[model samples]
Target: MRILLTSALAMTLAAMAWHAQAADPERGRSLAGQCRTCHGLNGIAKIPIAPHLAGENRIYIETQLKAFRSGKRQHEMMSVIAKDLSDEEISHLAAWYESIEITATMPE
Candidate 1:
């Protein structure tokens, strides 16, 4: 039982490390060229129709993209675009957008 638990933990860790390695923010930046029309290169939305992605939670981004890819979520543009994205590509995009920082200030 102990051995089985240890093995499971090791496998989980390995999977996490592999996922971390698969996401490349630089590659995502390059891929973002296609997204720049709606989502700015910096992850801000170019149009009001799009939502800002900068500093978004990584898991949230991944979840939404996966949903779009799987047809669980429907958006006219996102559904089509996400259909072609591999899991690694989604991870990279999530990593890149999550890496950005945004600040908001309250009126004084």
Candidate 2:
């Protein structure tokens, strides 16, 4: 009974930690202000040079951002920008872009 109780407690703590680490969209939105110059506030690209970020997969964004931050991926601007980002900041940015709704329309 004691062992079972300890296991349950451990599981509960693990679940709480997981939830705590979940990305926050509100924080992401605030942090994403700087990203607006290129990606736009709504995650749409503002110019031809930038790619649209709206509704992109969170994992893809996180991976790319991490790569840029670590210098594994090279980008003139992105490398500079990503260098200052923390892991949490990267997660938030991913969440922000992933939260946007996007749809593709088929041209008839």
- TM-scores of the models, in the order given: 0.84, 0.79
lDDT of each residue in 26-49, candidate 2, tens digit only: 788999998999999899999899
Encode model 1's per-residue lDDT on 2-107: one tens digit a residue: 9999999999999988887788888888888888999999999999999999999877999999999999999999999999999989999998999898999999
Evaluate residue 4 in candidate 1 and report its C-alpha lDDT on the 0 to 100 scale. 100
- Top-TM-score structure, candidate number: 1
Q: Give the TM-score of candidate 2.
A: 0.79
Q: For candidate 2, which ten residues in a row score worst on lDDT?
A: 15-24
lDDT measured at residue 46 in model 2 versus the true structure, 0 to 100 = 95
